[model samples]
Target: MFKLKRKIMSKLYTDIFDLATAKVYAVGRRSVWRDYFDLYFILKNNYIGLDESLLMTETRYGSVFSQKLFMEQLAYFGDIKDFSIEYGLGQKKIDLDEVKSYLLKVVKNYSQSHV
Candidate 1:
């Protein structure tokens, strides 16, 4: 009876999926993004989900924000920042204001929703 109870309880432990679920989110690099606002916009608005879809899996963990994931998240929100507003065009040089505006918006949104 004791052995049976122990086996049953142990079987209920949830490590495999629990760990994987816990590892889904990655922390953002605010300083780096703040310093390079334009680059940040390009990355956040265009690159978030692509990288996460590519990199995330049952056995993988990401320590920092991914290039693709960041952009994807940014694109989700359409703020059109300072750098981007001035230089917003397809395949052309990226705008600095656009990046700054987009980064601030995404980061703020992320913080509010996440909390």
Candidate 2:
């Protein structure tokens, strides 16, 4: 049981990350989106808390990584496996291409030093 669970992160965390952190400020808040489908990328490779693992947060805000910078770091994990855009009540079209590869890489690279 422990070994099985160890390899799995959890869909629950993915949902929270998408709901709480998925947004773009490249221009403004109105344009950014965090739809449900996009959570797959974050969940698949465990990027939910990559910044914390990497110790990339800024001292002033006490945040390991910003939304934009996070995705920037997500490029190292692998490649764009899958993606989708959702539109509905409280839903926005989220993109998930290439995020898994980058995030998995971050976890592998950083989890070691932190532990």
**lDDT of all predictions:** 0.43, 0.41
- lDDT of residue 60 for candidate 1: 52
lDDT minimum window of 10 residues, candidate 2: 24-33
What are the models' TM-scores? 0.32, 0.25
Candidate 2, after superposition: displacement of residue 23 in Å? 8.5
Model 1: per-residue lDDT, tens digit, 24-100? 32212232222244335334655333233324432354445354454354444333232223344665665555654
Model 1 deviation from the true structure expressed as Cα RMSD, one decimal place: 15.3
Highest TM-score against the true fold, candidate: 1
Deviating ranges (above 4 Å) for candidate 1: 1-47, 50-90
TM-score of 1: 0.32
